[model samples]
Target: MSQAAGGVGKRIAKGSMWLSAARLVVNLSGMVSTVLLARLLVPADFGLVAIAATLMQIVTSITEMSLSQALIRLDDPTDQDFHSAWTLSMLRGVTIAVVLSASAPLVAHIYGDQRLVPIMIVLGCGAALSGLANPWLAVFQRKLVFWQEFVLSTASKMTNVIVAVAVAWYFQSYWAIVAGIVGMYAATVIASYCILPRLPRFSLASWRTLLSFSVWTSASQLVNALNWRADQLLVGKIATPTVLGYYNVGFNLANLATRETTLPLIQTLFPAFAAIKHDKPRLAAAYIRADRLLVALGVPVGVGFALVAQPMVPLFLNPKWLPAVPIIQAFAVIFGLQGIAGLVTPLGMAMGQVRLLFMRDLQVLCIRLPLMIAGAVIWGVPGLVAARVLTGLYQIAIAMLLAKRLAGVSLMRQLRTHLPTLISCCAMALAVWWVAGTGWRLFAGYDLAQDLVLRVMVGGIVYIGARVILWIVMGRPEGLEREAANMVGKLRRRPA
Candidate 1:
């Protein structure tokens, strides 16, 4: 391997650790928040907050500087690059906050929920803070400072929980929970500046250097952000806030599996994909490997969740959230399929296949938007859940085609690579399902039949051991052992 190649492997190692650590931190934080808010507040409270946050999300996303992306993607970004990015960020942040604050009441009126205005304005502060964050945090990620990212992610979220819970308990209103989001993000912005080795300052000259780099990424990210949140939009319009709240909870849990699994793939595989950007052969191999890993990681995890969806939801989010169980299972399966097509999006993005990436999303939108609308109209909550799963399969089909066309990741390559993981996951799911006697027997308010704990434990351990045996026996996954060893080195480097 060349120095850059070695760097790519090391970076992947670091990204994996950082993302995994971040996932754990975020999940724990998310779990805590979900429990507290669910116990203290009702779906209606979550519903009120969701509408404001969703609109604010649109603002934050559209106004994004993509400074981090600009810095990381540029072949030779400079200090000036960092400075310009930060300047652009701060201006945008301030602008969004002011606009949002002014428009919050109007937004709430349009949504037919006047109470949402204050929450919208409250969350708007985060828009400004995010925009003002030191753009050099990208460099931390670029430099693979995984541990710092890990600590900061955990700490910031823990802060959010502490504040949110304290205020919610004292006031017994949803405002405290809403404000917690804004406060935590502000905290994160400050923490990022402190932790980053070289913080970027405001500079016009630096701004000029980064514009071209920032524009495309910013557009892509903006569109992507909108795309991700569209389901919420559909639900909010067609269903009641209480109904949308269930949808959000369902979506959240689904993401916990897919997002947790592929989160590292995006960061780690990007550098690797960037390296082999010019080589079709290497790119093809890389995509297949990534696809296989995604399947291996996602399939079992998703399947496990689907198996235990009923039990897990009640235990995690309270009985009031039972409506979310079906939706969560639906999305879990969707994400599982998408997981198998993971490389298509990143590989497409990295290889200047922006048009392909956009088109694929467009195709997904084409399939999803209409279906989502129709489903929301017809089935209401259940329709929402089915629409998500159906649309996901539609997108996955398109994703596979794009991977085939762009990266030459063939049908056989995908099948051959995924067969073992798929089989193992299926076998385990069946075992769990069988043991649960089809998840049918109810004990008290919950089903006691699904032995989620035992099923997941035995299945996961067996599947993982099988994968390890295969990886070693076949001498496959070109960099498998090296990556494992690299992970060990990273763990050793962590502070006591």
Candidate 2:
């Protein structure tokens, strides 16, 4: 490996470590908020909010221009670039807010839920606040200074949870959720400005440069969001708010597996990839290394979640949410497939191949959107999830093919590299399933929560032990063991 490649690898590893810590806190806090709101607010409340939230997502995506991404990709972005991006972002936010507010009644009518009107308005304002967030935050991302992002992001999530819990406890309505979102965005925007403390000029001087990059990036983002969220969008229209709420919970829970594991990796890689885009060898190496780590971590998390869902649902959630158990299990598998596929977009952007990313997303949308609609209409909730699982598999195939073409790494090599992790995860899944399935049979006296905790502990141990032993057996396949030893060596060499 070149010195540059080694440096980038270490930076990514260190950055991911920091980001993982931050996202762990963020996810935990989010879970707390989800649990509190689930218990306090009814499923219908979540459903109503889901309706408005979906509309807001659609609006946000439609107006999304990824100027932060552009800034990161540019080798030497000037102040004018930042000013231009910020100005465009502000306009996008205001435009989305106005459009959402004006369309609130129509959106409510479409969903046959008038409660969405006010929620849409509130969420719209929140979206606008998000737009005004200082673009200088990308400066840290561009340089792989992720710890600051960790601080800012975690603070934002903590603020969201505190305000959300208090409002949900007091008001006991969907407004609590809406208000919490507003607070979270407000906090994030404030933190961004504090980080840089630079006022952006309201100018269009750099519009051409910014738009040249962002046009395709924004299109891909819009299509990608639509592709993934089409089920929720369609389900909200056909199903009751309560049903949509259940689906939302299930979907989010499933996402916990993939998103929590891969999110930091993805965020860390975009800038890293862009830095070495001209160096094909280094870029490909970084891409493969990242892929291996994601599969190693993500597959087990998704499988474990599926294995424990039966016990987890009853223990952590109220009985009213029982319907989401199967949905969560199915989506878990889907997200596992997506854990690797999610790399396609960022990789393309980093390679200055945004048009290819758009084409890939457009391909998925052409197939997946129709399937989602059919599934929602024909089989209802289960069908919706099943359709997504199918799409997930499709995305995997498409994304890997694209990876081979863009990165010059064959699909067979990619699959072979992940094979050990796949085998280990499968073994771990079986072990977890057996434990969760028959734990009560073997140890008949524990309460549901105790049983769940025991199963999780056993599952985690089995998974880790199996992964380590299998890797050693495979001759330390993927170099994970080597990486661990290297980390230990570095730590020991440091002053105690």
Candidate 3:
């Protein structure tokens, strides 16, 4: 690698480390909050919040101008640019809040649950507050200096968990969840200024420059949000709060394992990709390396979590959440497969292909919305899950094709890059399944916890063993394995 490439790699590694540490803290606190809230409040509490949150997301997506992305893409943004981005962002937030607040009664009527009106109104306020966050935060990301991001995210999430759990324990009402949502955004806005200490003026002097790049991005965001959240919205209307709660909890838990694992890296990849976008070969190489590492790490966690969902749900969340086990299992596996093309979005954005991305999202939404509606109408939640799994696979194919077009990486090469991790994950899944099925007979006193532990251990062992053997057989290929070795060597050689 050239010195320039190596420098980019170092920046990515350091940035990823900081962001990963933040995610680790956030996810752990989030899990604790989830468990505590699940016990203190019923599924209906979760269901009510989920419905309101989903609606807020849809409305927000519609108005999202991708100001941060626009700012990041600029080679050198001026004070005017930051002020314009902030002005637009604040306006978008207010728009979302007004739309959501005005639609609250209608949403409540559609769901036949009057409780959602207040929830939606409150969440809309939170959305508006989020707009006040420092627009200059994007500069840290653009420069690949993520420590501030780490502090901002961790502080906000910690505040959310602390406030939510305390409220749940005391109030024993769904208001606890609402309070947490508002608190998180408030913390975010406050932390953003505290960290950067910037006084952004309200101006649109650079509106044309910002909006020019964000037009297609906004379209893509709207479509992508609808594609992802339509099912939940539909479910909230068609099913009872309790049912929606189960589905919501299951879906979140399933995504938690995979999303939290890859999100830090994905966040870093945007700026990293942008740094090398002018050099197609370097950009492509970066994408491939990032995607491979993501798959290798994400696939095992997703699949392994699916394998253990049956025991995990009961052990961690109690029997009331058992119905969520299958949902968790199904979505976990689907998310795992989707990670194969996880870096495609960053690649496209880095390459200035927002129009292509918008088209891709529009196509998926066209196909996904119909299938999801049909599935929800026919078979309820299970049918919806099945439809999502199908669409998720389709999305993966579309993403891979997009990667090829944008980066000039072939479809064949993309598949081959993921083959080793895919195979290792498959082997691990099979081993765990077998151990949980017939192999349990060997232990005289096998329990749910024991089975879960045994499966995890076996899966970890089989996956590492298989991955190592494959790496060796492939002549120590220059990929995640090599990266791991290099990282280890660096750590060992560091001065004490």
Candidate 4:
């Protein structure tokens, strides 16, 4: 590797670690908060809030300018660039707040729940506060300096957890979730300014420059949001609040395994890819390496979570949430497999292929919305879950094709890259299933918590063992195994 490539890799690695640590803290706290809220409130409470949240997301997505992304993409963004991004963000936020608040009554009527009116209005205010965050924060991302982001995310999420839990305990209402959402956004805006210490000026001097790049990005965001949330919206409309609540919580739990694992890498990849976009060879190599690592790390967690869902759901969430078990089990593996194409968006963005991304999202939405609607109408939640799995698989193929087109990495080669992780995960899953299925028969009197712990332990051991054996059998190729060894070496060599 060239000195520049090596330097970029180091920065990317460091930034990823920081962001990953932040995600770790955030996910841990989030899980705790979810557990507390689940115990304190009924599924109906979550269902009611999920309806309002989905509408809020749809509104925000439609108006997304992606100014922060544009600012990050710029080689040398000036103060005017930052100011313009901030101004556009503020404008977008205000627009979303107004639209959401205005549509509250209609949304309530559509969902047949008057409670949505207040929840939607409160969430709209949160959206506006989100726009007030410092645009200069993009500078840290541009430079791959993520410690400040770490601080900002951790503080905000911790605040959310504390406030949500307190409110849930005291009020025992769905409003607790709404309060947490608003509190997180408010905390983010406050923390952003404190970390960056920037007094953002309102300006339009560079609006054209920012928006020119962001228009396609905004379209992509809108489509992507719809692609993910359409099912939830349909469920909210067709199903009861209690059922929607079950689906929402289950989907989120499934997401935790995949999103928490791959998202940190995805968050860092855009700036990292952009930094080296001029070097095609290095970029291609980096893309493949990152893709492999994501799959290798994410797949086991996802599949393992699915493997243990039977026991895990009952243990952490209690029997009341057992209805969510199938949802978690089905989606966990699907989301994990999604890591195969997880980096596609960042790759496209870095290659200045936002138009292609928008097109891709549009294509998926066309396929997904119809399937989602049919599934929901025909089979209810189970049908919807099955439809999502099918669509998710289709998306993986689309992402692979896009990756091949942009990076010239063939589909076969990409599949090969994922082969080792796939094999190891399969091994891990089989071992865990055996323990849960057959071994549990051998070991009598095992409670839900014990079964969950045993399965997790067995799965982790099997995955690591299989991975190592595969690496050796494959001649210790340059991939995640090597990367892990190198990181370990560096850590060991450091002063105590």
Worst 10 residues of 2 by lDDT: 437-446
In angstroms, the error of model 4 at 296 is 0.7
At residue 417, give the lDDT of candidate 3: 91
Per-residue lDDT over 98-215 for candidate 1, one digit per residue giving the tens place of the 0 to 100 score: 8888998887777788887777676777777767666667766666556666767776788788888888888878787787887788778877777865666768786655666555
For each candidate, give its TM-score against the true structure. 0.87, 0.95, 0.96, 0.96
lDDT of 4 at 110: 77
Against the true structure, candidate 3 has what lDDT?
0.89
Q: What is each predicted model's overall lDDT from 0 to 1?
A: 0.73, 0.82, 0.89, 0.89
Error of 1 at 319 (Å): 1.8
Error of 3 at 240 (Å): 0.9
Clash counts per candidate, in order, are 2, 0, 0, 0
lDDT tens digits, residue span 1-496, model 3: 5887788788889999999999899878888888888889988888889999988888888998999999999888999999999999999889989999999999888888889898999999999999999999998888888999889889899999989999999999999999998999999999999999989999999999999999999989999889878888988878988888899988888788887788899999988887778888877777787888898878888999999998888887888989888989999988878888688888889878899989999999899889988998999888889999999999999999888888878998888899899999999989998888875643677477787888889999999999989999999989878888899999999999
Model 3 residue 340 CA deviation (Å) reads 1.4
Q: Give me the runs in candidate 4 sitting further than 4 Å from their true place.
A: 439-446, 485-496
Model 2 clashing residue pairs (backbone): none
Q: Which one wins by lDDT: 1 or 3? A: 3
Between 3 and 4, whose TM-score is larger? 4
